[model samples]
Target chain A: MPEITFRQAIHDALVEEMRRDSSVFLIGEDIGTYGGAFGVTAGILDEFGRDRVWETPISEETIVGSAVGAAIVGMKPIAEIMFMDFLTLVLDPLANQAAKVRYMFGGKATVPMVVRMPSGSGTGAAAHHSQSLETILMHIPGLKVVAPSTPYDAKGLLLSAIRDPNPVCFVEHKLLYKTKGEVPNGEYTIPLGVADIKREGTDLTIVTSEIMVHKSLSAAEDVSKEGISVEILDPRTLLPLDVDTITNSVMKTGRLLVVHEAVKTAGWAGEIMASVSESPAWDYLDAPMRRLTGKDVPIPYNRFLERAAVPQEEDIVREIQAIVSNQY
Target chain B: MGSNKINAAYDNEETTDARKKAAELGLTNEDLVSMYEVMVEIRHFEEMATTLYGLGKVHGTMHLSIGQEAVAAGAGFTLQDKDYLINHHRGHGHFIASGADVNKMMAEFLGKETGFCHGRGGSMHIADVTANNLGAQGIVAAQIAMAPGVGIAIKMRKTDQVALVIFGDGAANRGVFLESLNMSSIWDLPVVYLCENNHYGMSAEVGRVSGKVPFKDRAEALGIPGYFIDGNDVLAVYEFMKNAFSHARSGSGPVFVETETYRILGHSKSDRNLYRTKDEINQWKEKDPIIRFRDLLLEADIITVKQVDEIEKKMAKVIEDAVEFAENSPEPNIEDVMEWVYA
Candidate 1:
């Protein structure tokens, strides 16, 4: 195992996949000489040459639509939307075209394409560049949505997404790009519908993903000082949700909490809770299920306001403390 | 002025002159006959489809390309099975032109299991990938954005195959159309952007929407060669498409072509024929591609009037058999609704 930044892990996964499969190519804005907006594709042009690394104009719709077209004809295209907020401009290609092509064509066509969107607010990019829109993608039936929390999961999950027979939306949080974690140096892949229990506990269970996984872990450490044990679970892929893992954890702890960086209303938090309540875990609950998520407001440029918009370590800790104390 | 130039090039009704022009384009007697047969096939398919719609046998609205048979036949006859075609919503003619199986197309329209999309796509989304006929899209400009990617795929595979994308005049105003042309031009991708300018896009006339600018200017601005051809003349469209496909296959980048044609029917089943006058529709009917090409072949003695009648009879039988196949085919199993959502 080698420690690598989440960004390096993603770059490594792309390099490995492109080397292994000739059909795999990267197309997006500034992906060639400019090396992508976040530099995830930095220096990849030198190795793969101009054909595989295409620098496109600022046309999000055509970029994703062309990826769908290329993917249909036996090419694996990984398109970048530059920012998750811009995914609005590409909904027709991503949701209507790429997501539905396989089923619409009676399985005669497959869009093996991955749309990588850099998401979340933390670096003061304001409302336009900062958004946790993975929930929007999850609503589409044919699309697979993945949000990884660590470098290892980022590399492995991305590999699986690239090879998945259908369209996959890979959401990378801007703040998590530089976070370091142990990642295997060789080829590896984590299955899409699996959940990872970041830490084991006995009193309570917390389900979360992306940047919130780190916040939940820190919150668990803080709650432990108050004689409360908390389990943290990250459902890496949101669409094919791992209900069994989530329910099993809830059954053992007899308490559950869902945390995410997305907005509160109509978010994955409520969906996860609904799934758990419908499962066998409903009878095992000793406490009501709770959610800690971003407030319903646009992310502001002010650092304090941005931090207040989403869940922080302290917010997660406070939520755990309140739930344990029967504060509802 | 531009329309007059293009019309004059194909206004020659002389039998010998038409044969000479066809020969100049390397079209033999068999090719001409096959071309005429395909045009007749499209005309019959559309007319029958309209009848089926009237009888409430076909579900969902369908956009008919009744008067645009020559555009479909000329381009469809020019393409190889390995070449790709991206079609728009009003694409039954385009699909038939690209060698799609009539049985499957009719089955899909009738919502049967044996259809190309297992009855999932219905009239607007028929696709025959095995024949390289990428599915027709319901979205107005969706195919335009996706066509350049097919060109990219061909370029990547180092295949000489070119992607011939067909859209309506209305699609030219979309941003993705411009974006695709720019991308294909800069990358030197093998693509032919064909705009079937059938006067009106839905109720909005092309004259009102596109103004005085020719459709070719859309591509010419991007450094791609643009051509305006008389779409009602099958020979003219066939000859121009031949040069365009070759130029694209030569890796000279994409070419844009606008076929000046008309739609004798309304835009869709929902249209009431309220936008244009009946006189306008009748005027377009006089220049019918199928009748014009048949007259040319008959006068040239390239084919007998008896032969032309036989093609109409044979195509009528083909359409009848297709309807029977669809009527007897099973509906998709409801239990398998979850199937094919992914690979």
Candidate 2:
């Protein structure tokens, strides 16, 4: 095992998959010669040649639609939408055609394609550029939504998504690309719909994903000194959610605090709360499930307001402490 | 009589040359008869469907391929079992000619459990995977763009099969259609794009929608060979399709065919015949493919009027039985609505 940044891990997954399966190819803007916008796929063109590493025009619809077409014809394509917000332009193909094709054709057609995008705010890419839209994609029925918070998970999960017989919306947190973690070389996959328990505690179950997983874990360590133990659960995949892990954590803690960078209104946390409340964890609840999410506002350019719009480690620390203390 | 004489004069030279070519290609009379039967089957199926819809038995939108049956019939006759097909909204003829279960197709339109899609997908979306009828889409030109991908897969799997995509004249204007054509041409994918130009795209005439460049010329501009044919003539359509399919099967890239025909009905069930004049309708009706083909078979003494009537009666019975079966079949379970929403 060796330490690698999240971006490197993703690049490794692409390289390995392309080498292993000739059908697998990469297509996106600047992904070939200029590398990806995040530099994750840097130097891939030199390795795989121009045909496999396609440099597409800045048409999100064309990129996604071509991927859908390629995937249908037995090519496994990894299409990169430069930014997650730009996914809006290609939603019809991804949500309507690629996602629904397998079921619509009665399991006769499978769109084994990966649509990777750099998601969430923190890069000062205000308003239109910075958005945490994982919740919106999670709401779509036929897509498998994955948001990996670590380098190890990124490599493992991207491999799993590539091999998945369904369409996957793989969201990578923009800020976490440079974050380093131990990743084993060679083939490995982290199964979708599984949650990782980062820190175990009895006081409160903190459910989160993407970069918020890292924030929650850091906050948990800080709150542990204050006599409040927090259990941090990272739901690696959103659609086929790991409800059992969160429910079991809630059963032990008797308290749940859902935290995400997405806006609180109709966010992925709401689905988590609904799933938990319907399970056996409902009887084990000591308090109402609390959601600490970004304020429902467009991320502004002003640093203070931008920070206020999303949850930070301090916010998670304060919210979890208050929930554990039962403070009003 | 002068027009007939000229047509006969051209036929003498063309048919003699075509027969010589057909013999060189080892095409038997059985193959010709089978091809003719496919065209008749497709025409009969669409006519029955249109009649049922007019009688208010079938619901929702229906885009009949009555006049353009020869295009689908000819192309489908050339497909191998492993070959794939993607069709547009007016796709019943394509599916029927490809040997999709007639009962399941009728059941699909009736929204029944016995439908090809288990009643979930209706007429425009009917799909039979086992038969390699990938699916039909309502979106114009969308399916044509995906044909190259199917061709790519067949090539990758080392299967000597090609993908046949059929769309209407309206689809040629779409960017996806051109994009897919370019990709297929560049990659030399085993595919054929059959553009059935029935002269209407929901009340807008083809002449109004498209510049007067002609459909086949568009393909020629893309550096691919294009074939223009009278789609009403089944044998002519078949001959052109056979040439195209063989070219693709031999790894010579894709071909484009423009089938000139007309739609007898409106674009959909809600459409009124307000766009065209009564004289125009009567003119095209006189050229009705089913009637024309029946007359041709009668003139050639290939079969008696009684035999033709027997075929019609048999197809009508099949349609009626399918309708009854669909009417009796149960609706999809409400609980299952959320099941297929995910993988």
Candidate 3:
């Protein structure tokens, strides 16, 4: 395994998939010659040619719609919506169309496409550009939502998302793109609906995903110095949530805290907490499950305000400390 | 016919000329007769659908293409089985003309297990993928946005298959419509954009909703060749589609066609006819495509009055049997509610 950036991992997955299957192609705004807004698709056009790497008009609706269309017609289309916030433009296609087409058509159709949505904040790219919209996509039942927090997870999960016989919404955090980690060079897949426990501990559990996974790990590392062992669980694929790992971790740790960068109100953290509460792991929990997520406000542009809006390592650490102290 | 100014530009005379030269266009009497029969079948099917809706057999409200039979039937004649068709909500006519089985379609409308979608998709979402009818979308302009993908697939597969996307005046105003046209044009993808200008989107008239801009100009602006045709004229529509389909199959990119037809009935089941007067309804009824085509066939000696009567009688029996099959079919099992949600 070679250490590679998350951006390179995603690009490598696309390049490998395209090489393995001619049906696999890339389509989106500036995905061709200009690379992508986040440069995740840089040099892809030169490798694949204009045909495979389609540079589309700035129409997000048709961009996703075309992917659904191509997928049903036996083509693997990986469409990129430059920002997760723009996923709003694609709700009709991704949600009402792609998500529902297979079921609505009585399983006669398969939208085997991947909509690569580069998401989350931390860059100075204000409200319109920096939204963690994975929750919006997760609400749609037929869609498979995956948010990869590391280079290894990004590459493997992307491979699985592209090859999956249904529509998969692959969410990548903008801040994690350049982050480097060990990733296998050729081909591998991390199955959807599986959880990855980054660190093991017995005192408390922090279940998180996307960029927050990295933050939680850092927080757990710092909390270890204070003699509080913490467990970090990342539910990489949010839709088919790995409840067993979450509940089992809670069962061992005896305390649970859900962390995310998305707004606190109706965030995915609530869903995770509710799942744990309903499971047999309920009796094993010695403390009430709590959420350490973003503030209930639109992401601010100011540097300090932005940091304050979402959960940082410090917030996660504080939450872990409070949970261990039996604080509400 | 009375108030519509666009119809004056392209009228039934062009269709009459096409009808006269049907043989010259390599259409035999049998082919012409078959086309006529399809139109009659569509007319009967729509009338039956209307009756079904009235009796509350259809699960949801359906957009009926009652008066616009020729646009669907004529295009159906030109399209091969391999060609793709992306239909709008008002797509029963498009489906039947695309060689859909009436029994399956009726069963779908009735929410029966034997339906094409296994009753998962009712009237608004009927799709026969095996027949290349991609599916009718409930959202306006959704099919327009998706047509280019089918075109891309066709180009990639190196097939001569052309995707015929049928939408309405309402959809033309949508952004995806322009985006799809631009995409298909730039890529030189095989797609034929057929806009059935049935005058109104819902309650708003086409001129009011779309303003003074015609779809032909909009298409031309996007680098696509646009044609304004009389949609009520079956022969004319067939003639235009023959060329449009050929142009698309030849890798010449998409051709935009606006068929100026009228929706004889109200928009949907809930429409109260308050938007327009009965005079307008009766006026479009007189220009009915089925009757017009039948008379043309009769005058040309391509089909006799007795043969026309026979087609009507045959279609009536077909629809009646479809109704019987649908009514008698078993309901979908509750256990399978979540079956098709994935894969």
Per-residue error (Å), model 2, residue B270: 2.2
DockQ of predicted candidate 3: 0.84
Model 3, range B273-316, lDDT digits (tens) per residue? 89889998899999998888877777877888888888889999
Report the C-alpha lDDT of model 2 over B1-343, residue by residue, as the tens digit: 1111101111111222334444655666456545556666666667777777778877677778767766676677777788878888899888887888888888888777778887677888888766777788777877775676676666666677878889988888877766677767766778888888888888978876676535777788777888777777666677787788889999899999887778877888778889899898788888766666556556655657887777767666766777777778887777777556555
Candidates sorted on lDDT, descending? 1, 3, 2
RMSD in angstroms, candidate 3? 1.8
Candidate 1 residues A75-102, lDDT tens each? 9999988999999999999888998978
TM-score between model 2 and native:
0.87
Q: What TM-score number comes out for model 3?
A: 0.98
- Residue A48 local lDDT, model 3: 80
Model 2 pairs whose backbones collide: none
Candidate with better DockQ, 2 vs 3: 3
Stretches off by above 4 angstroms in model 3 are: B1-8, B11-13, B17-19
Worst 10 residues of 3 chain B by lDDT: B1-10
DockQ of each: 0.81, 0.31, 0.84
Tell me the tens digit of each residue's lDDT in model 2 across A88-157: 8778678777877666665567788999999989988899888989877887778999999999989999
lDDT of each: 0.89, 0.80, 0.88
Q: Which prediction has the highest lDDT against the true structure?
A: 1
Candidate 3: lDDT of A200? 92
Interface RMSD of each: 0.8, 2.7, 0.8
Superposed on all Cα atoms, the candidates' RMSDs to the truth, in angstroms, are: 2.2, 4.9, 1.8
Candidate 3's residue-wise lDDT over A88-192, tens digit each? 899999998899988988888889999998888899888999899788888998999999999999989999999999899999999998899999766789999
